[model samples]
Target: MNELFDQFDEFEDDLWGPIADDAMEPVADLSVGSAYQAPVEWNGIFTSPSEENNAYLPDVEPMDQTDLSSIQSLDSGELQPENMAESFFIEYPVFDPENADLEQIVGDPAQDMENWHMQSTQSSCALVSQEFILDKVLGRDVTEEELTSVATDAGWYTPGGGTPMNEMGRILEHFECQVDYDINCTMDDLSAKLEQGESILVALDSDEIWNTGADLDDILSEYFGMPGQDANHAVQVIGIDYSDQGSPKVILNDPGSPDGSGVMIPADKFMDAWEDSNHFMVSSGASQVSDQMIGNYYDRYGTWYYDDGTPERYNWDTGYY
Candidate 1:
């Protein structure tokens, strides 16, 4: 194998980021009710909202775990070893999504999982983020265990290492999701996608994204005050914080940090970290197109693609395809 690190980002060593062991909870009954959203008004003319077309869900909270009876309090000799979440990956639980609930799964899974801010195990960042995106588009909870198990069985994830940098689309495709993968994506590509209201699963260097000094000991790591050393993290871009257009921050649901959800960092830092893995990314918005539809898209768009892997004649109204 080459000396260069393979592009992957499950969990390296639990060396950086917050560990929220107590926060990992089973995602059942996480669905929320839908309420009617008021329609827009134009020049004193208010459009009516039909029940089927106007319902909007409220802000969803991430999983809240309450079972902590196993934690040991300060006792003279009862000091048990800290509960290590990494131990769960010894044999990853293969969670199958097909058997998952498929009824009325119509809300963003992030709303139910709250961006799934909880930290991920060394081998579950991609799985966790994938769970969120899949569940969001499918409108239900697709457990991480199912994603992990399938990825492992499918050879997308190495036992101790992470996933290949560009297989995210194939994984999504395996689930029949309509996907677009880009190996050399640009910042404008990401911003435009977010503008269209779609979350992106991105691979960036954890060292830059979290500013963790875990890799500094390595001679090749960017000396202090720089990034692009460790290519070991996967996150989902939920939105872009444009409070400062000059230096807009990229908001992400980062699985590497303890409170990984709603994490934000300057766009430049994100881009630099992204460069560690060639700005590889994947976005899946609609369900996989039928074989007939696939034929039509290929016949129309051919093989020409933009930097973001978008077909020139893609139907953006659908997914910035």
Candidate 2:
């Protein structure tokens, strides 16, 4: 992981371009009743234009500009950690289409548990993230204790260790799940996968998702300055929200959140924080093998087996199969 961070540090001098001078100006206030809205225009933030007649686009107006003060503070480098907001809120519109089949794909958000103040289980975010996907997306009843045991046996937990992206893949394989670790994937790639009824696990800096009372600008600035600062944390991407103008917002299930409910973030903000880790993510789903059968095999044999019924025998000493 350190090597990965080093490589990312050397890849660029600036992760994003300078913030436009007029970036903070609110474009429209589309707020209706008591519900929040998406901002109409973004000055410096850039998002991919929607594909022609994309059927997944939500039927709602663009978001209204809430408080963009943090953005300005980030641009000027004068933001302090003590002045950060308690939370960044964005109300995501429901995904409703006339076609019943399509609507089924965009169903409800996954259930998740919070890891807000639990420091002893710092490295367990990946396990928690995976558990939510299995339970909610794949219809499995997985308890946190069961996942912790699996992670411990897989050598994914240490006193102060973090789960590597590759380890996450191996862990999923135990349940007969296939995972693709892509460090070069874009938000569009994630959206496409969600449309196909797949769930995504993304690794991001912790500050980007939690409200730590620290200026987000300062936190991000410091993160870029020292790439080795252990900024890896995992979350699941379960849904997408499209603005009236067709821009997409990412909805995440942050295990680290207090409530662990769906958290909405603008695509650009999420991408910027994601870029620090090379946009690392694990796109996973049920594998060709039977999940139940494979899980039972792991429980009995203490290791995963290949599709051909060969044991993935791990040599405890060398820590490799």
Candidate 3:
């Protein structure tokens, strides 16, 4: 995790850009609304030489400007820990266009204690970020030998699953997520892997993920300073993709991916690419994981430690203390 943040620090300027006005509020100020947009003027007239006549043409007026105060101007620098707002927010896309549904992918599961939110989203809180999720799901934090051992263990592949792989898959399915398993397998293999009430990990591509900007590529290039293909920095991949292929895409699910709507990485590049960020993982318990694996989960992450030598907070967001 330190290594991952070090990567963040190394490319801090490129990813987030320089911190514009140092403000600490994790949540963007929603008071004023998005940038002030001018209102459209109806019945405006324009003289067109092409018309070859002095005619009163209906001029299309610009729209009224919105209150810019509510909407904060985002940049790469905003990814910094110190500058992160008090409450992060992200708008999830409609994964199932056929279904025409849209919702926020990441949030406090405590709000919904029943349903998949309780078992899947709630239990894997540590996987809020793409990097952490990938590390744990793929066992990236573990070495190649460890991964191989776990993959070939056969214990991970049996029915009525109890292995971490099976358990993680069930957790991911709540979000309709998929990931490249330690050992390559097809749809059938994945389906068979599930237990009576198990799920599959969602493998998200960076392009499909949503960001502050209308285009996700722009956001990745600007704020995070990481390229769209940088899979090493696995943030939580969110959003629903409904097409011939179901892709759960999202912004890098870092501590800064607003409201926990994390970013996505291509399954093919998800593992090798994000390694460029020097990622790591931290896990605990039978059915509970903090949103942050170990790095920056929230504002006070990495600041205080517990008497039992446990960390009081995690820095999944990478917000400065």
Candidate 2 segments whose C-alpha is farther than 4 A from its true place: 1-120, 211-213, 216-230, 244-247, 289-321
**What would the per-residue lDDT of candidate 2 be over residues 179-208, giving only the tens digit for each residue?**
788887886788788777676888877655
* TM-score for candidate 1, residues paired by index: 0.51
**Where is model 3 more than 4 Å wrong at Cα?**
1-82, 85-181, 185-223, 227-231, 235-256, 262-321
Q: Rank the candidates by lDDT, best first.
A: 2, 1, 3
Largest lDDT belongs to which candidate?
2
Q: Over the stretch 245-278, how does candidate 3's per-residue lDDT look in tens digits?
A: 4443322333333344322333334433333433
Clashing pairs counted in every model? 10, 8, 85
Model 1, position 230, has a per-residue lDDT of 64
Candidate 1 residue spans exceeding 4 A from truth: 1-113, 117-120, 212-229, 288-321
Estimate the lDDT of model 1.
Answer: 0.54
Q: What is the C-alpha RMSD of each candidate to the true structure, in Å?
A: 23.1, 22.9, 23.2
Better of 1 and 3 by lDDT: 1
Tens digit of per-residue lDDT, candidate 1, span 1-321:
444453334334322334334323221231342331332322222234344332231222233334545577554321111343322211111112244232312123335236464433454677777777776666555566556655665567664466777766555775568778887898778867765656689987776645444454666443432444465678888765554568766667766555455555677877888888788888777665342332224322144423322234323223333
